[model samples]
Target: MRRLMKLGAFALVLGLLWSCQDSNEGQQPQLEEVPDEVLAQVANLGFNADEVKMYDGVLFIEGDIRITLDQLEKMSPSDGLPVEEHYHTDNLVTGTPRTINVYVQNMPQKYVDATDIAIDRYNDESLNLTFNRVSSSGQADITIRASPWYYYWFGILGSAGFPENGDPYGTILMTRGYYDNVSNINGLATTIAHEMGHCIGFRHTDYMDRSYSCGGSPDDEGDGGVGANHIPGTPTGPSANSWMLACGSPEGDRPFTADDKTALGYVY
Candidate 1:
């Protein structure tokens, strides 16, 4: 009986050791270090490392902004681009309330898809935003114009919305080629998001954060302003992969981040 008891105790100790080994083997892998370029992008976007968190390996980030169309329009466009003359119109000017007309000149399907995605981003209730095919006589609030080459350059360009001044914001011209490629051939969703961001009052930036990127720097008053830049959600980039700035990165694509969703909530 004493020998049997000793054997039982030895077996129990071995079982516990084996269980511990199995548990260690099943543990999730540790995260790899973030690359410097990604860190730089995160820093530029205005996110702190402490503000970023990872869940199931994906990063989540949130930002708060109070920008308006008036703020964007008052800012100047990029220098190489032609000066944009401001115009004004109202949703009630023609007795139609809250109706904003969009004329899609080329790449109709892509434009439609973009509208769908944009609406989805806004939870299917984008305010005062509507679309139609091109019309010669109908005074439209926005128009999209593009060519195959232009599409190759930038998926979409220009945007029209009711600025604070209240004139039917003029046309948002897009390169048909980029839209076609992005929609059918290339299927590049990031540029579409970027252009839509422009439509909704966002701009390009090497930085992704507003505070960290713009900290101590004078507020950017140009077309590619600081307010429109993205904010970081991960030590690597804005949320693990952001559709806004990732298109231009070595990773070559960025989906949407929580920061983007937050900004959309503000705009939509």
Candidate 2:
């Protein structure tokens, strides 16, 4: 039956991802969580271990998510103040020291291409960014995989990268395949930049907190602040022109805003 076949396919995908789903089901490993010392080591890289712990742990991500257009419409853009362009490498934080790669297993090639282009646009010339297979001793930046979910979506919500260890190391990305059926994939670049921004210790430019001196609606301002945290002139654009804005809005400009550069300089 078609239902049975679908279940079989789902199992197959899970097997490939975990390699030991059956044998290791419910068998939690006894590896140590990131320690304070480890966090201190990457303090300059961005990301706080304590904060990351809120989301860290074995995750059962259903790469096969199904979000309806109505659901998409329901999701609101984050409400927070934009991050001021004042990234301090000294203030960076982290948990463990590891790198991850992203892949879009069943996603379309066009989405993949779009992500690559976004990376090219954001990375400075000195970065010389490129994607390749991850290796233990080679270049294992991050590995992204395309999802098999008919309705694929990505965001900080399900991503474990934020609450992860290391000095806000990078996370590679890919898209789910079936959604690839549709066209006009304009959001891919915005998605990548948004996610990558998290990896580099940049929070949502519009993260809001009422208790702070920069008071306003909580999370009303985006993570990137007025001019963006970049070197002067390098990340030219309106503070609001970043690609990492809330959903439903047209994509932000391609170039990195000042906040973006300041964050990058903090880590790299």
lDDT tens per residue, model 2, 38-146: 4442222221222222112222111111222232232222312123233322223343232234343334467567556655655442332333333242344544444
TM-score (C-alpha, index-matched) for candidate 2: 0.44
How do all models score by TM-score? 0.39, 0.44
Tell me the spans in candidate 2 whose CA falls farther than 4 Å from its real position: 1-86, 89-104, 128-139, 147-160, 163-186, 209-238, 246-254
- Among the numbered candidates, top lDDT falls to 2
Q: Where in model 1 is the C-alpha error above 4 Å?
A: 1-99, 123-139, 147-169, 177-179, 183-190, 205-240, 246-256
Which 10 residues in a row give candidate 1 its minimum summed lDDT?
82-91
What tens digits encode model 1's per-residue C-alpha lDDT throughout 1-268?
0000111123333333232112334444443354454434333433333333222333322211112323322433221111011111111122223444555554456565654454354344343443333355266555555422211211112222323333333444443322232323213334444444434334333233323332343332222222322222323223333344312421133445655554443333
lDDT of 2: 0.35
lDDT, residue 21, model 1? 19
